[model samples]
Target: MTSRFPTRTSGPSSIASSIRRPAALGAAWAALSTFALSEPSFAQNAQPPVTELPEVTVTTTTTAKKKKAAKAAAPVAASQQAATPAASAPSAGAPAPGSRSGSLSVPTTAEATAEINRTPGAVEVVPGSAYQTSTPATTIKDALDYVPGVFVQPKWGDDSRLSIRGSGLSRNFHLRGVQLFMDGIPINTADGYGDFQEIDPTAYRYIEVFKGGNALRFGANSLGGAINFVMPTGYDSDLFGARIDVGSFGFRKAAVSSGGVSGAVDYFATVTAQETDGFRDHSDGESIRGSMNVGYRLSENVETRFYLNANNVDQRIPGSVTKSVALNSPETAAAGNLLNDYQRNIDTLRIANKTAIRIAPGTLVEVGAFNVDRHLMHPIFQWLDYRYDDYGAFARLSDESRIGGFANRLIAGVNLHNGNTDVRQYVNVRGQKGAQTVDAEDTSRNFSAYFENHFFVTPDVAVVAGTQFLHATRKREVEFGATPGETEFNLWSPKVGVLWDVTRNSQVFANVSRSAEVPSFGESVNVGPTVIPFYDIKAQRATTYEIGTRGANANFTWDLTAYRSEIKNELMCFYSAFGNCNVSNADRTVHQGLELGGGAAIAKGIIANGANPDTLWLHASYTFNDFFFDNDKDFGDNELPGAPRHYLRAELLYKHPSGVYFGPNIEWVPEAYYVDSANTLDTEAYAIWGAKIGFDNGGPITAYIEGRNLSDEAYIASASILDRANANSTLFEPGNGRAIYGGVQVKW
Candidate 1:
């Protein structure tokens, strides 16, 4: 939270005096690593007739022990270009070629094999120059912690508790069965909970994870599916940016963005603010966000776009902490500030619009609309006193054609959600004198219809299908207890897949899908009316299967996947006393997993024998999940609580020569790994290694410094299950130790 460093140069034109040979600035940083593999638009707007794009500055050295590279000094002409806002365009990656109309800027493994060979469910995409030299994360679950079956646990620091595949296994707080979007609106909560501190994850430029039933193009009752966060448009980042970060417990962050064009219109906007002082005890929080996008150009085919997102947050709620206070001291804190000790505020809003048309010539058509609002302020414990307000609206239409020999595409959608909540209760004794209020009023009505298609059977092979039809209604009215209900459920989910391009790089895919879940409002009215009163529980079905393969050229690359799912009713969670909790429905369940990853550049004579074109990259992954529980008898074979069968990550990046850059990484998880659900004790397997260094001058300023866990390993990125009478050897969250940070960045 202290910036100021311009021993010369400040915007306009800089990058060390605009490339004055260093081999043309190493060919303009390899053309910015292929312009950060751009694709995934929506970044427009920035001053008069849209000029933006020209602002880059970063500085930090409040006692430099190590980490100095703030660069600055290079500004001499080309007044503004635009595009780099929207919270600094989440690290802008690029995408804007044919710009809209017939839009096609594929890549990200050909958009995950064209949505796994033509949609039908199950998808994945994580691109942004492949996490452009990571180590600059501000959520988005810490850059999806190395993707692969995603699992985010940020506890008190920035509040995140995501789960994919096993979607919010039983939830403790945020996220429930996936479903989160940005650009197409919807970020949960409107009765369909989801919260990762309104996600800022560095403002995103690419991140699409649809795991079951291909998320029916968004609006298919998530059973762990759907996640889209893309931003960065306007002819591939025009430019004008900003970024700043200060670390350790009392962290701080700031972001900015601005894009190009104006007149024919094209825009961008991004803003962010963050704060943290968490490590337990009275935590502390602060959040701010803003996003904007605009585009127009109604001729030559057609194009239209507009998107806006906003968020505000306030926090303070530590709670969970044990395991002998997390290994003798996981930063202790949380000893009853009781009565929920108040403090938790949030506000969110979203708006969207999209339009694309191209009468013929490859043919294409797209339409979209969106709206979402959420509000929450909760406080309670003695019994349960909550408050919430939700809202929703959505619409979509899609088409892509080629007729002639065969080539087609189509998608359709609709959604409208509503919400309500206001309840109170305080009196489990403890100086009880006055307390008792109610206002259940709940409603979650949904009507959905979806379809997808892709068939080219030849010319590289292709086959994909899709389906979805959901009509749901869940009403609750308590005015004051006693019989208040309304339940109506009707659902259908379908998906099929096939994709074999075996050549043109590589490919393979498979799919089978179905999912339905319904039951909230504290899982059907948290006890009362003498037990089981306001009923409406039915709709928890699942059946998923997946297969995968991936490939890339220019020196090797890879991706692999394998999955399985089977569920019925299943929605268990019964934890009595202390933080109580009870959500029924559990009869059968099974889920399998396997995901291998790849990345390579292993010296081709150090950049094809030309010496320092530098190059050497490697990436890795492994997941084996096995969750089980069939015909429950109070939790069977155990091992079904929060991911862990083996999760791994590895990295090594080095790109040097004048602009230098470094990397080293490893993250592991082992140990019996049972943090709850009657899984008596377990937790071991640990590994840690981290390193990063940076310096780039292609314009604006660039500098970096990082070191995490660097051997101080006392791992536990997530844990929960404290007190099973030392029998469970109690476990409580504990992660974060061994920190080192450095920052400096500026763009314009």
Candidate 2:
């Protein structure tokens, strides 16, 4: 099949008018699948968002000669990569280069950690080596369980309630505040809405969590920050690997991956498939995902990479139940869900390329573009079909040098993302389309330019400053029922901070930043009972003050941060008529919290009179949340719903030199917060226990056994939002019951 770019039309149109199609984003996808069967890597992306990537560089005349030279050296690079298995570590001086990302080669764990330490705010890097092979990391929740200040509650399947610093806490369903990325490319739609169903938690080398406005590097300007799920390259991954997992609730999963260098091209590919009957009725789901990346070296300082991704997801939503039903009969599905056979199904494909060039010493430039095509078939009270065509381009320049005899690091980037959606709605006849109800077209355009700089004031301290400019527009053309709606937003956010190097491995940092969120088409403007183009609704804005310290020494490592957000025109979801919701702006609110995480080795040598020395490790994460309205008209000083006031996750493990380990973990919520703006009702707090035993030798073979919620405690997992909730409100989602899972992996 041939892929074509979209052409601009003069006037508004309906869904039946015309639509675009894309394919051939598949041939390479097949290559990835085939490679996975022979050998595998864990860098997975949501069913590759079907996309077409346009080259973003100047073609050099020496391409032919460069290719030939690269081919000659490929064998040496491949052999060196093959020598290191999955569990090897890179040195701090010379980087163990993998594939190219941005204007530099992909770095190993140690290098990645060193790079992220430059951020003068709350940020962290979670290495895949820590969980990818040994844990059931099938979703984002599993990958981020240890990150402080971020809250992730699994709902069902790959869906979850995820938040950073109370972002999108009251606006339920699908991600709103956080920007999700795979290998530095955006997975969110043009309008900044996010979904995690396509993410394969097992397919990543590392995940970066940038809390609040620290995400300026990625052109992300939001209250919740950004998460970058980075896949490994040929040099960073095992030559080949495979794994399988099975557990209670009729759950099963299998994955395979491979990476190698042949000639000038180095590649990494992975595939995964899984299904489960689910712990609650009407919650069955299944998915298959694939990802691949190919790289070529035009020269030592200039290179380009190609990426392919695809996913197919089908999920049955159990729907929220009343609080009593959630705790008493947790397995029961809502009657309305069963009656309508509610479900969310999607198919996606994405193809893209990035080029990095070293223009001069200490100066690098990167440019890339991509296209995404996705289809969404959803059935609830009504049948909704949406076809998405999204494309974007990005460019960045980074330089490190001295100015006035002072060290300086400078970075700047710009991004443009635009898309159109073909929408058709029909009366639902139990999961099937009935008579057509409406046809429409939705278009979104977003553009952003950002820059951040660090200027060293002294040998041990630095000053940081940055700013971002954003422009967004939303247009909806309705063929029937409602009138057309078109709106636009523009914002400028600035940041300033200071960083003090307390030690070679530790730092103290603080920052003051501003952020803004423009509403998505999903949250259209409504006035009284009439739907219109717009009312007085405006973009959500916040000013945050943050301070923190993070570092490690000897056997102790810690990360702690505190922050407060004073918000204006906060966007919130309120109860609309007929079990629906609408977005509105609130007067004022305050959000303040503390995030703390630490790990230490308290003892050593417990086996056979210290004959075989071992270490006892304990890791803990704690969060304190205080979110409330600031003397509003309808709700006065009421706590905002959606999270617990106090949450903790802790684990204790015994480690040996041979990589064999065992650990017990706990998830605790001390008290429940309100579930509604009026504070009429709240959820119940509870604790769950789990354990893990694994042999992560990173040799020819490895295995693990895991158990979750072993006590089978009944509790609420997540809840919906409303203005004034009551006892009979169907807003609670029950937590999963006791379950056990085990998996074995082989690497070569």
**Top lDDT model:** 2
Best by TM-score: 2
How many collisions per candidate?
Answer: 48, 24
Error of 1 at 513 (Å): 17
Cα error of candidate 2 at position 139, Å = 1.2
lDDT of 1 by residue, 433-535 (tens): 2366554667666667777676655654557777888787767777774357787778888877775544444455566778776666555425443254325
lDDT of all predictions: 0.58, 0.74
Against the true structure, candidate 1 reaches a TM-score of 0.31
Q: Kindly list the per-residue Cα lDDT of model 2 for residues 1-748, writing each as its tens digit.
A: 1111011111112111011111221232242232112212111111111221223343343643454455444322221121112111111232312222322445556557656777888898887766765577788877888788999999988899998888887666788889888887788888778889989988888888899888887655678989988888865566687989988887889999997655456678999998888999989888889998887867667778888889877888899989999999999999988887888777888778888787776667889988888887778778877788888989988777677877777889999989999888888777678888879988999999999987877755779999999998888888985456788888998999997665554566788999988877776546467553432467889998877777664466778777778889787755454444566777898777778787777777776224445667787888888788878888988888887888898888777656578879999997877888888889999999999888754355678898999999999988877778789888898999999989888766
Worst 10 residues of 1 by lDDT: 77-86
RMSD in angstroms between candidate 2 and the native structure over all alpha carbons: 12.4
Q: On a 0 to 100 scale, what is the lDDT of residue 170 in model 1? A: 71
Structural RMSD, model 1:
25.3
Count steric clashes of candidate 1.
Answer: 48
